[model samples]
Target: MKILLVGAGLSGAVIGRDLAEAGHDITIVDSRPHIGGNCYTERDPETGVLVHVYGPHIFHTDDEEVWDYVNRYQTFRPYKNRVKTTSQGAVYSLPVNLHTINQFYGKTLRPAEAREFLEEQADSSIADPQTFEEQALRFVGPDLYAAFFKGYTEKQWGCSPTELPASILKRLPVRFNYDDNYFFHRFQGMPETGYTEMIAAILDHPAIEVRLDTRFSAEQGAGYDHVFYSGPLDGYFDYRLGRLGYRTLDFERFTDQGDYQGCAVMNYGDRDVPYTRITEHKHFAPWESHEGTVCYREYSRAAGPDDIPYYPIRLVAEKALLADYVALAEETAGVTFVGRLGTYRYLDMDVTIREALDAAAAFRASAAAGDAMPAFVKSPL
Candidate 1:
C-alpha cells in the first residue's frame, strides 16, 4: 500500500517508519524544510550549543517502549527538568513543592506541616471548582495562585484564569516534599545529539521518502491508498468552519556570557513581564559546555493564520469550532488525522510518538481486514 504522511513531525516520522518497515511505500511531506516539528533542534553557529529551534522539548515519558524506541536513533542523556519561576520579584521552584511553600511564605514547616498549612490555605467554599482560577485556589489558595498561576496563565493563553477550564491546571502536580522535578514520568532525558538527528534517523528507512518543503494537499493525496494528516485539523477543511483558537509564541533570541538564568527554563509569573518564560538552550544539554549561552524569551499570543500554532486554546468557543472540524473529518474519507495539530490538542513529544505508532498499527490492521480507518485515533473535540 502507498501511504502519504502529512507533516514530518514525530507523529508522521514514526508512522512513516512503521508503515515502511511493514512493506508499505511511504512518502512524508512537511511544509517546513525540516522534520521533528516543534521539537526541531540544530547546532548554534556562534555558541556551538544545540538549540531547540521551535522551543525547548525535553524528552520525558514513563513508557519504556517509547524510550527504547527513541534510543535506537540516538543516545539520551539523563536530564531531569528543574524549572524555576519568577513571581513577585522572587524566584521559586515550580510544581509548588515544600521548598517553594516554605520560602514563599517565610516558614520553615516540615512536610506534614506544609501539607496541613496548604489545606488551610485552600478555599473551603469552592468545593467543586469550575475554572482554572478556582482549581488553583482550591488546591493552593489565593496567594500562591496569584503569585504563580494568574499572570502566567493570563499571558500564555491570552485569557483570564476564570475563562480557562480547570482541566488545564489539573496536570500540574503539587508536592509536600521538595521534589522539584517538573515531570513525574519515569523516563526523563534529552537526546545527546538533539531531536532533529533522532527524527532524521527514524526517516532514514529505504521504503520511506521524506520531502521537506513539500506540502501535501487533499487533491494531491488522492492517489495514495491512505492519508495520515498531522497538520492543523482546520487546514484539512481549509478553515470553512471557523479556525480553531491557538496560542502561538514569538521567541526573542539573545546571547549572554557563561550562564543566563542558572536553569534551562524560567517562567516569568508576573503580568508586567511581556513574555511567559525564558529558555536557555545550552542548559538543556548539560553534557556540552559553552563559553556563551543562547536563550529565548517566549511571548505567547493569538495564533494568526501565518503564525505557527503552538498550544491549542480549547476555550468554549474554540471547542465548538473543533466539534465542527471533527464532524467534517468524520464525513471525509481515506484520511486519518493524528498528532497535535491534526487533533487540535497540545500533545507532548512522547504522547505524539505513541499515538502515531498506535495509529499506524490500527491502519495496517484495518487495511488487512478491508475495514475503513477512522477519521481520528483520538478525537480532536
Candidate 2:
C-alpha cells in the first residue's frame, strides 16, 4: 500500500517508519519547510547553541517500550525537569515542595509538620472540589494557590481558575518532601543531539519519502491508498463546523553571554507578568559546553487561524465542537486522524510516539487481515 501521511511530526514520522518497515511505501508531507514539526531544533548561528525552535520539549515517560523505542534513533541522556517559579516577588521551587513551603512562609518545618500545616490552611468547608480554584483551595489553601497557581493558570489558560476544570490542576502534584523534580515518571531524558535529528533518522527508512514544504489537499490525498493525518482535526474539514479553540504560544527570543536563569524552565507565577515562563536552551543539554546561551520568553493567547496551535482549549463548548468534528472524521472514508492536533489533546512526546507506534501496528494488522482501518486508532475524547 502507498500510504500518505500529512504532517512530518512525531506521529507521522514514527508511523511512517513502522509502516515502511512492514513493506509498505510511505510518503510523509509537511506544510512547514522542516521535518520535525513543533519539536524542531536548530543550532544558533552566533552562539552555536541548539535552540528549541518552537519551545522546550522534555521527553519523559514511565513506559519502558517507549523509552527503548526512542533510544534506537538517538542517544538518550538522563534528564530530569526541575522547575522554578517567581511569584509575588519571591523565587521558589515548583510543584509546591517542602523547600518551596519553607521558603515562602520563612520557616524550616519538617515534612510531617508542613503536611499538617497545609491541612490546617486548606478549606475544610468545600466538601467536593469541582473547578481549578476549588481544588487548589481544598488541597493547598488560598494563600499558596494565589501565589503559585492562580496567576500562572490565568496567564496559561487565558481564563479564571474557576472556569477551568479540576482535572487541569490535578495533573500537578504537591509534594510533602524536599524533592523538587517536576515529573514523577520512572524514565526521563532528552535526545543528545536534538529531537529533529532523532525524528529525521526515523524518517530515513528506504521505503519512505519525505516531502518538506508541501501542503495537503483533497486531490493530493486521493492519490494514495489511505491517509494518516496528524494535522489539526478541524483543519481536515477546513474548519467547516467552526474552529475548535486552542491556546497558541508566542516566543520572544533573546541571547546572553553566559547562564541566564541557571535552569531550563523558570515560570512566572505573577499574573501581572505578560509571559508565563522563560526557557534557557543551553540548560537542556548541559553536558556540552557552550560559551553563550539562548533563551525564550513564552506567552499564551487564543489561537488565530494563522497562528500555530500549542495547547487545545477543550472546555465544554470546545468539546461539543470537537465531537462534531470527530463524527465527521469517523464518517469520512480512507482517512485516519492521529496525534495531539488530530485528537485535540495535550500529549507528551512519549505518548505521541506510543500512539503512533500503535497506530502503525494497527494499520499493518488491518492490511494483513484485509479489514477496514479505523478513523481513530485511539479515541480523541
RMSD to the true structure for each prediction, in A, is 0.9, 0.8
Residue 93 in model 2: lDDT? 94
lDDT per residue (tens digit) for residues 197-269 in model 1: 9999999999999888987678987899999999999998888988888889999999989998899999999
Candidate 2, residues 228-288: lDDT per residue as tens digits? 9999999999888999999999999999898899899999999999999999999999888
Question: In model 2, what is the error at residue 228, expressed in angstroms?
Answer: 0.3
- List ranges where model 1 is wrong by over 4 Å: none
Q: Which number leads on lDDT?
A: 2
| Per-model TM values vs. the true structure | 0.99, 0.99
Q: lDDT value for candidate 2?
A: 0.94
